[model samples]
Target chain A: MSTTATAIDNKKGLWRGGVSPFKASYGKLMMWFFLLSDAFTFSTLLVTYAFIRWSAPAYKGEASDFVFSTEYWPIPEKVYEAFPGFHGVELPLVFVGLMTFILIMSSVTMVLAVEAGHRMDRKSVVKWMLWTIIGGIAFLGCQAWEWTHFINGTEAGTIGDVVKNGLWINNYEIHGANLTFNQYGPPAFAALFFFITGFHGFHVFSGVVINVIIFFNSATGMYERRGHYEMIEKVGLYWHFVDLVWVFVFTFFYLI
Target chain B: MEQVSNVVVQPADRKKIWGIWKVALILFIVTSIEYVFAFTMSKGMLLNVIFVTLTIVKATYIVSEFMHLGHEIKSLMYSIILPMLFIVWLIVSLVNIEGAAIKGARGTQDFTGSNGATEQVDEGH
Candidate 1:
């Protein structure tokens, strides 16, 4: 048989074997579809955020009208304004900036790892993957800190002064606690914030773990033996998806 | 694997990965803009509009550059972006409806409470 005939025969045999029908590789295609679905999920959450904010009565107070007080949707700056120490200075949204920076940096490292994979540079691939993992961990740390600050409620002693009302207003008392429902905007807002951001944070944590494993595998030449590092690209897709969702969260939840 | 055609199969052109420093620079610039806006702009409808616009721009850069989605096929891009837009529309409509209901409820509650008390006082007198 000629070379062309032999190639055609092999193609026919493989087709008859009844393998997966996807035109692209299974991993890459799946990542694309997964990202598409995830995009929808995030959009729903953001939309829900908007709906709640709109439906909830808006208090006429400015963002800085209250400090460390749960009064009026908790002001993104007031809820997230911590930075290691420097307590009582009231720096709003500074920690969120740190979190955003960390995630973006991790994304940069992830892209570098994907590039190194394309170049088949095992050493660089491992190194960049490790860096990416570190960045992910750092982001998770920032998230944990933000969560702690939020759940602990800033200035616990003042809780008695707030009254329960639908409106989130400053100086309101809820159930004799200084933190009124009005001051905090609504309970649903805090609940959704925790759920959505916590879910994203969990994804980041998992991504870091997966990156660590890939880093080790690359370090030991496992993918070199397999002759491909497509895994890196797939993980990069997930990492990017996480970052993309954060953009929406920051825009709708924080900035808006 | 059909008969491997004799046509020239050019190697896929790999795009250059943006440098970390450049990515860092972009992040810094975006964050600085966010900070400046947060501090300089008072909270209101104008601030809300500007903040959301800037956020979308920053997000686009991150998605296109960091995620490398810019190199993807047109179909793939639409598959992602279109569904997201729909979700946004749905959420906005729902929120607006709820806002109207709450406003109505608050108005009714105030009217009934005051009217009921007045009727009872007139009967007592």
Candidate 2:
């Protein structure tokens, strides 16, 4: 009878308000909740993007026949084809692919740092954190370059039946994309591009700042003195969340 | 204070480290596949389906392995994931009906006049 009472007490103890039912540290649990909210925010953004893209009329004809026009949605491949140094050379998806690779590599490095932290290896954590920071900066640099290219309209030649002003005016030169107008297609395309990628970029920027702070904290043996490195794990979760969001952004924006 | 003391920090092991690299490798491979498809395949529903599926695959690996959610308690994991299902539902329903309504209202082909000759005037502009 005493054993039964104890078992009942044990089962009830989970909800007795003294124990953590989830078995997660308070900070970590709060971080997860924060991340969950963030996921909803990103979801709304991407869903809006998808809705807009879907509502736009699909481009018809061969991929090679695609030209900038108000009449149809622009082919993503044709619009995003310009390579930085190679300028006019059409290298579709390569640069964005490189950006994706950079973000993923940084994410891996962050995981390594967290892993090292688990072992209480402050030296390894600092080293890996440094690499993660470098990777984050590199990605931001590439995004900056890409944005510059986007703003500065490409060389103005009407490539095969490009339309302007809702009429096929002769000598219609292509202007770079802005929120007001997009030489690519509808103005909404450029607007969404700016909003979505800009928002994601801002997240990356803030993540790098936080990462730097944590890197210093680890390097100076703050966690070491505390006898734990849970801080790294929490920050690592944030870093990985950034990467996860990028995976979706890359797919919806570039690949699809 | 006692709850805080209960926080357990698992030490790193070789197997777990290997698992991280394996996930990274999978992500790299999936992205490469996406690139190949982007160039080779014609734009259509089939291609979009493929890309979306592959993207989910990549997202799963990142969330499960990199974020370490898969190793967490089942309730914690479900608490995070179950809410996201609403997002999926939102995408499926909203994008389908609203997107079609928008396309119908705007009628790009009808409004802009795809042919060079038709001087169709759009009053909304």
The lDDT for every candidate, in the order shown, is 0.66, 0.82
Q: Which candidate should be chosen as best, given DockQ against the real structure?
A: 2
How well is each residue in A1-256 modelled by candidate 2, as lDDT tens digits? 5666676665556666445768889999999999999999999999898898888766666666566775456777777777778978889878888899999999999999988888777778999999999999999998888888887767762332334557655434557877766677767888888998898999899999999999999887778778888988998898899998999999889877
Please tell me which predicted candidate would have the highest TM-score against the true structure: 2
Stretches of candidate 1 exceeding 4 Å from the true structure: A1-24, A67-71, A156-185, B1-24, B96-125
- Per-candidate DockQ values are 0.25, 0.42
Could you give candidate 1's per-residue lDDT for residues A4-74 as a string of tens digits?
Answer: 66666556543563334333467877888888887777766776667666644444454434533332344
C-alpha lDDT (0 to 100) for residue B40 of candidate 1 = 88
Q: When only chain A is evaluated, what TM-score does every model earn?
A: 0.80, 0.88
RMSD, every candidate, angstroms: 8.5, 5.8
For candidate 2, the per-residue lDDT at B120 reads: 27
TM-score of chain B of 1: 0.61
Off by over 4 Å in 2: A1-12, A157-174, B1-12, B110-123
